[model samples]
Target: MTGGAMDVLPAAPAAAAAEPEADEEADPPAAAALTLSPADSPPAPQVSEPRAPDSSRMQMPPGNPLLLSLTLQELLARDAVQVELIPEKKGLFLKHVEYEVSSQRFKSCVYRRYNDFVVFHEMLLQKFPYRMVPALPPKRMLGADREFIEARRRALKRFINLVARHPPFSEDVVLKLFLSFSGPDVQNKLKESAQCVGDEFMNCKLAARAKDFLPADIQTQFAISRELIRNIYNSFHKLRDRAERMVSRAIDNAADLLVFGKELSALGSDTTPLPSWATLNSSTWGSLKQALKGLSVEFALLADKAAQQGKQEENDVVEKLNLFLDLLQSYKDLCERHEKGVLHKHQRALHKYSLMKRQMTSAAAQNREPECVEQLESRIVEENVIQTMELRNYFSLYCLHQETQLVHVYLPLTSHILRAFVSSQIQGHKEMSKVWNDLQPKLQCLFAGPHGAPSPPRSPQDGLSPH
Candidate 1:
């Protein structure tokens, strides 16, 4: 099999394109175009008249060699026997040995740098938008250590296995070329094929209509998640701000109490009689002032620490939620692209089939050239095959999307759990405050002597006077 074997032939030139000459006959009364909607009732299988096999007909060449007699399970039986990170002057390369069940029949080694994998994954995503392309490992800035390389090696193997298991994706020309070719040839072929696929996808009319084909329920779910995430982020932000303000006020009050205690101590023994509720021994007052200052400083430090931690935690949650939303959006976009490509191809095939059928009927009536009629018949067969494949690809994508929705349900549930957790923590803080308030007076009384005057009730304004 030649490298870069395309599954579908390139589109014929527009001018030379085969179309029933409209003037030849009134356009065969316009029949309804085939509807490829996944939700629609399945069409009854067509039964064709039995015919003798024609041995004289030439055998068609296979489009892709990887599709030849290889089951997905058989391909996946190949294992990564050894993985190594080889350091080169330019950078690092990941090398691995693949051993098939029959070692003698199939054993090979492959090498790919990190960037190569990244490029390959991107191309795969573009080419097969509906397929669940396994995610690459997160990017690491630092050079590969043993653990990092080992983890990446395992991830890469899993990714390869996933690709191999997917029938349509496994037969992708780029993937086959990448695995079998080496050096510059692999890179060149992969790049060329990627560009071709990309260009074809871009030109597809279905791309424009892809969003319309999305299930309404999925769209609604996405909208709900987006709104929920936004609300949670804003609510948490506001809660963080209010908590900080309350902590700030408490610290200010503590400082004021410390200052008022210092003033009372400065009044001295010769001072005019202090209010019975306000009088205390100077030594006692001094100790109280020091304790207040210490407690105030400690509370301030704790508040700062708590505020930092709370903010950090809130940021992390919001980030994760946003990431989930982003992932959903990305998946939808990929689905749209996949649907567009498949639908576009299917439509084109339908168009060709219609044209050929009309042209063949007209040619037969006019006793026209047999060669032209044969060509038209051949095209009809080819278009039918292409249309069948496209339909299969379309339905597969639809099924995949439906399965993915099950996974998407978790996003909103996770958000709800996180929101409840935050609320519970806030409630816990409120309960702690109530407990502290109930204990404050009892704690103060423990420090008072039996003959000593009771301390005046502290007010927010009491201790804030400047020296």
Candidate 2:
């Protein structure tokens, strides 16, 4: 391409020289006017299409085979001229067009056209920043706002389609993009998604209400319902903010209840002692205290059995409740730490988002009105930041309840279970020890005689084993 490029010069006079002779001896008027005809044209041969330009127009350096090959290939190829301009590195003409490659050498261009542009782009990005290189003269900035709008609309549609394919993305981002565009089609799609989320939120609210009828001691079931309600409430806000008006009011109302209810019903403490009014009666308390002491002399044989069984039940319930409370506290601490992180990220995102909103508002009211392309583009970026912040907020609450492991459900439920066990132990002991110590001896004597001999035991199969 290089060797052949040198033979062609931009100053070559063939085009001019061929014109006059070709026009001579023509009819008087035609000849005087400098028009040429078929017979008088050059003999190299002519077809309907224009001939390739003379090689002299293309300039090239000597002895570069690669460049030569490129030039020769271009000569034989038809259609689509190639132009290359290589700028100098770290020099006065760094950004100027130093190497001009025309159609004559383009057919054998080394890089694929698209890849070629990228290569140049990367070079420009690196070099143009640090060097005082010459740059092309400026022209008008972004003419034809409508053309750009059409282009942006297509681009945004494609982007939304791509994002929809990913599960993790929040729909709030999608709707914000649509709202910013204010295009009918985009708005319709956003509205549809909002409706779906709105429905889910409503269903969660209904389920939560139903759970309120359950007994207070059944804490786990209620906790599950409440957590569900809270999740839906968070989703409702995110969707509502994005313009999901169909169910917006409903979701908003539900959210109000869920949020405020949680705040109002918030546990004073993760733990509490047994209620004071639940204390045992005086007679039962007396027996309980005696049981606590060594009862070997009065009820000698049954002393260890009663004490061990009663103490075991008390120890089991206390141990389980303590473990549950400890876990609840740990989870709360972790949630607080996470909330701090969310708050920090939210601050940064909101700052950027507000700046974008201000820019858009200013741009919208201008005399010419900023192009929809730029407005939508800026909104796309800003909306991303907003949605990210919102998601962070949702995640903070999600962690707050430790919903991933269902701890909110587990903690309260464990408390209820412990209460039931404690009540059962107190009631059972009261029933079994109601008789006085002397009454037991009287009963035994009535059955046989106070001095009567004991009855012989039956075969082992006649009685149940303790275990």
Candidate 3:
């Protein structure tokens, strides 16, 4: 009642006090003949037009982000994307791993030091998306176009020539095959295709027909039909085809599988090439020596650590070193004795001296320790001089047949023997001397009784031997 709009409507005209009679059939003019305009026809029955789907809206179902996940690039840039990773189900990843491991070349070469670079590089490239990069041919030929082909021809020719300097290509069987062809054009065509490594012209059927063109010498060397060569080539081709298929499959899924595909795609390409170990170089020798030195140092430290920690390990290292030292001493003794015996045979001294020099050079190259290397070199020089002088002395003894100067011959021989004996004793002492020296103090510490009681006595021989 307080609202003003309620009172604004004029009060419905007061109902007339007298009512007029209405015809029963006419119901008050049928409610005054109501009519509706097009706009007023109950709002045109409100035929709800189908709505267009919302273009800018997105929705995700509960517990699943599949419908509304971020793009891979966005995921990568996130500071932390905690994903509940499940173990891989068996399929292509496992299959490729098995294939790779089962391949003999992969097993022997892929995991080793020298061949690993090639195997791994090739395998990674084959297994990764990097393989999608198309081969971009070299802009400039490394050699003349025909140069490579001619080089191959020359190499094959050289091999055939070495077989007997016979013409391997222009033999009687080949001539007969050409004659059978009924024209020189076919022969020229065959020659053209033969230059290609895997061309079908080199097939056995063609070779059989051309057998008359081959010389007897060539036939004797090859000893087989062109078919054999073709089959061999085809077999290799099949192998390569299979490998390519495997490589494609491996690459397709490498991202999630961690199969290292990028390395595989580099096979036979300019970008990814062979490693240093695959080729020879003087620098590689230096690297090898450095690696060996590092390994030696590492082993030495390991031995020292083991010595400080465990009695068994300490003994094991000492025993192995002792064995190695003993073997070296034996080799030195054998070579020294052999040199002396060879010197007595002056007629053969020159040849024997060369052999001894090679052995000495090898020993020098192998010896790495500063003191030991110098000592060994000095010893080798001394032995070489002794051997030389003895040769001369024995020659004089032989020519003069005199005992007066024979003592010179015997003296040098005796010096070598004495040196060998002293070296042996010194090496033996080096191997065993520290065993007790180090153990005595450690034993004293271990034996000091609880509450600082006096240490117990140990046998004098305890820990004296290296092993």
Candidate 4:
């Protein structure tokens, strides 16, 4: 019944019965022939052309899709960012550490100092006011020991990776410049790039209209998710500290084992060779003395094994835990930013607008000056800036909800991290079991019979009576 293209669809004889017979035409001689409309009008254009019939009208789509179909979750899953940080010596005395960054995102390697990272962090804060740009690690610690240096490097690497891997930040010009630019004036360059904060509405299409775009329960979902994540962060932060202490204890145990064996060797080497505790009867005491002398060597090997285990735990468990903590910590930072940064500015804008409204109203009522009132009216733009502030507030909330959802999406990483932890534990325990096995034969040799021949292994059945 519709006019334009459906009329030409009638030309297809196979499907013509689906359409009502046209008023303008009688039955034609052959059913396969084309049909035309009434005499008053020319035949409708072949609007429903056959496949491969035409090539002239091929064209690109009109514009970007009206809806936001791009998802942060899918983008994160598909895109990969590989970044490596190798800290090198810097400053005249070689007292400073500068990171040599090799970035897959840039396909380039650049040398950046702590100052460079600081500048870049400042720029990111300005550029993406609503995004969760994690805070940078402290610039310096009380003592710049090897542990501190390595920890600092890891923190900086993690922070950068978090920023780079984020979908919105991946396209940022500020990020691109900081990563790829190797100029002497990198500081100035970063400042110029992020000189002004961006307009929130321009960045988020439905920022001003979030009521229509976002879900009805999105606000409640955000609050619940944030609180859950916060609780997780608090619990896991303590857990991370406990994990660090566990690793430290392992390292300390390794060191203590080394010292313990050495101390035993020193005691055995004392000039007072046969103390009362030795219970030497002069005949068999020589063999016992010899065993004591070589005991340090056996124990030293065990200590070395302990040290290796400590290293394994550090890499596999503690590092993975730290990686997850970094993500949680960044979300924590984003939540704080929502309150202190965006909301604070929005409130200030409102306060300023109110003050201006009062000033303008009072000036007009008192008839203080026509020029003054006109100036106030022009600058105020009839509550124009307030409208922008309102939009930005809504936009900030929109981004906050989206970022919270992003955090939830990444929650599955905990499983992978835990799997790695269990594997490392298995490997570490197996290695220590091997060390114990090596010690068993050495113990038998130390207590060997008179000719220094090693004692044969004793079975558990030999110790029990079988009746």
Candidate 5:
């Protein structure tokens, strides 16, 4: 990742890398290419041979690791790259909210429309059907305002950053072309690259040997973590909504204060024809009118302060909450995929294998012709291949381990968010208290200057300062 394209992704064996358009993993090693002199190579994993089912313990046929050996830090890609999304209105009438996705990991800037994100997400789901693929932000056609566009941009940014940081997805031809290819038909290129590519189990390489690295109580741990993350997501989601509502109220209050100030100023400026009540107490009225006019300045200033504080709350609290929630959502998706997607497929494969085994046994026991028994045997072999792939996927706790580790690695973000939230709250309360403290003396000076002694002069450094 530190180097340019060549350095980030090593070329696969030359034969596999021949097509500039084809993915490195698109074409499996040709039969002839794998056919070396018996003395030149050691025996390969005998995947074609059948083995008895052993339900007592998890196991996989020994095979070469599918993926290159890399440290956890390398896989996380924490400091390796930066993903930036600059949004611009590209349509002639501002109908299109286009995003320019730029990354040091890719060759150049790629402008992606929301539709492009849609296609890219679909490809991810298709390629890694059982893996946790985060959902894209909902698309809308009629409402593309600056606010909506900015929110969607943030969502899309999170989506791409997560994908870019992932070791497998980072080097994936789908992602590489989506980010780098300068061609007009990027959607087509994405679709093409997704074809012929194997699933995550094939790419992960360590999936078959997951039991060797994972703990014995891996299932229990995954369940517990998933439950914990769900609780956090639910709680934080409510917190974010409340924070947003609080900011909205601040904005509304600011607008109301401005209106109040204007009305008060109008009352003070009415010298055209004094009302009967005003004339009855002309001396009192005249001075009171002057104070009323001056009230506008104080109210307007307070309104501005409220508006500024509202923006601070949004950045400090709501944004941070959103970030943490996004991570939680992804983890939840992983939990769901493991149970409903991968587990279900694995069960179905088992059922199919059992059915084929029964068919072969029945045919052989009936004293059937050799051709019939051979045909039944061949069908059972085909079913065996399906079982192997499914078994690898079912036991692939390695991906789960990486994802769980990723959650812990990024969990510190929540603490940073909470710190910022508290700091903003403290700052906001201090500002409000200062406003009331400063206003009391100003009111005494304006309304009681003649009748009562003027308030003691304030010091130069009377304003707020951190203790």
Candidate 6:
């Protein structure tokens, strides 16, 4: 048996086993090739490929870094800023809550009181002459009212967010510094910086050029819109004033009517003897007077309430319209400023190019100073490129900022005012209907006695029927 094991196996069986092993190794490569081959492989389960990202969703491109360091998205990022109110208890003389404005970018917290926000809002308005700074919440004389403070805290947060989102206002170095720094030192620094920026912006040649960028048609539109808003505001204000006066008069008239009704009642009760018809007439007149007084009093009360409500609504509409007008004006001013800067630069480039072209033409004509002509041509090309870029930027800024303001602020505010006005009219109609409904039974009862007949014709002696 050992000798037989040592002997070699049959060649055919050994060859057959070796061939199977080789075929197995080759199967892996064959399978891989088949998997890669489209014709041999089964249809790939249709996968819904992810759609390409929409370029429109991308944030505004960073244009001239010197002009703006942050995109609107970055500036308006919800997580970039946090405002918290920290309550502190001091000795009996000093207990206060501090408004902390924390900037994620600067990793700094600015501690301020409510008064500081008021000052900051004022400063913002003064510093950025054409920008619409958000209004601060009204100040409360009673400090440390928890609900009031909490409400104020929310408003302040929105106020800060609005300021930060405004491009020109947000880019102001002083504003950013104020938000990032604490203490009086920073305040003084910010004030000085703010004055410098304001002065520079106002006095610069750019400001002068801004008006040229706005077309005459656009200016006309703005003027027309402003006038319309002003007229509307004035009309509403007048209406409110008239309503208040009417309410006052109605209340006074109601009091006088009430007194007259009482006097008639007393006269009717007098027991002095009189003719039967005369007594009937006296009683009828007294009853009629009392009914008239009751109806007058009811109507006067309703009128007073309606007038008061109308006046309040009118006041609100007037105030809202006024605020909208102010915002519109601010938006116009900001657009003008931005356009001036861009247009001034564009015009400068154009002027430079023209001057260089003239110089190049003169040099070429002289046939003496080809090199100078070449230099002038190069400079002209540079100027042209700059001019083109500036023109593009001007259009982009106008469309992006001004158009957005019209859509977001102007249209929405106008629509809200119109809707409110319509609603007020509808409510007035409803209230008038209610008053008529309420007075219907009383009016019907005024003419009829308990038996629904003229109080039995008084002995038919008098020519006048009780009816």
Which candidate tops lDDT?
5
Clashes of 3: 37
State each model's C-alpha RMSD to the native: 16.3, 36.3, 51.4, 19.0, 12.9, 26.7
In model 3, which runs have C-alpha deviations exceeding 4 angstroms?
1-411, 452-454, 458-467
For residues 1-467, could you state the per-residue lDDT of candidate 4 as single tens digits? 11221211111011011123252123222211111123211222211211322222222223321122334345445333433445555557556677777677478677888888899988777757766677777877445787777778878777777787776677767778878898888889988865443433354444446544444444445445644765676677786787778778777887887888788777556555566766545445555555566778867877777777777777766765776678766666665566555456656655665565567678889978666677756654534554554555555666665565555555656676577667766776787688778766656645576665766767779889676
Candidate with the larger lDDT of 1 and 6: 6
In Å, residue 135's CA in model 2 sits off its true spot by 62
Assess every candidate by TM-score. 0.41, 0.24, 0.14, 0.70, 0.71, 0.41
By TM-score, is 3 or 6 better?
6
With candidate 2 superimposed using the best TM-score fit, by how many Å does residue 335's alpha carbon deviate from the native? 4.7
Q: 338 in model 6: Cα distance from truth in Å?
A: 5.3
Q: What local distance difference test score does each model get?
A: 0.45, 0.33, 0.28, 0.59, 0.60, 0.49
Model 5 Cα lDDT, one tens digit per residue, 380-443: 5655555454445434445655555555555566677778877877877788677767767556
After best superposition, candidate 3 residue 333: deviation in angstroms? 24
- Predicted candidate 6 versus true structure: per-residue lDDT over 1-467, tens digit per residue: 12222112110000011133244223211111111233222222221222233322213334321122333344345335667888765657766667889876567788877777766776776655434555667776456578787757766776675666565555566567768766676656656655534332332233323334433344334334334433443454565456446445545654664565456455545556667768756666666665665665555545555665456554445445544443434443444444444344545554564565667668779887457577756764565455343433333333322333322423345556667767765776677678768877766545667555644334445667565
**Stretches of model 4 off by over 4 angstroms after superposition:** 1-94, 141-143, 195-208, 264-283, 292-298, 344-382, 448-467
lDDT of 3 by residue, 52-121 (tens): 3332222222532111122323222322111121232356543111011111111221111112222322
Give candidate 1 regions above 4 Å deviation: 1-117, 123-128, 132-292, 308-320, 373-381, 408-412, 419-454, 458-467
Over 229-319, each residue of candidate 1 has an lDDT whose tens digit, in order, gives 3354355446545544544454455455445544443442233544677665655765455445334433443344445434444444433
- Predicted candidate 3, C-alpha RMSD: 51.4
3 versus 4: better lDDT goes to: 4
Instruction: State the weakest 10-residue window (summed lDDT) of model 3.
Output: 96-105
Q: Write down the worst ten-residue block by lDDT for model 5.
A: 9-18
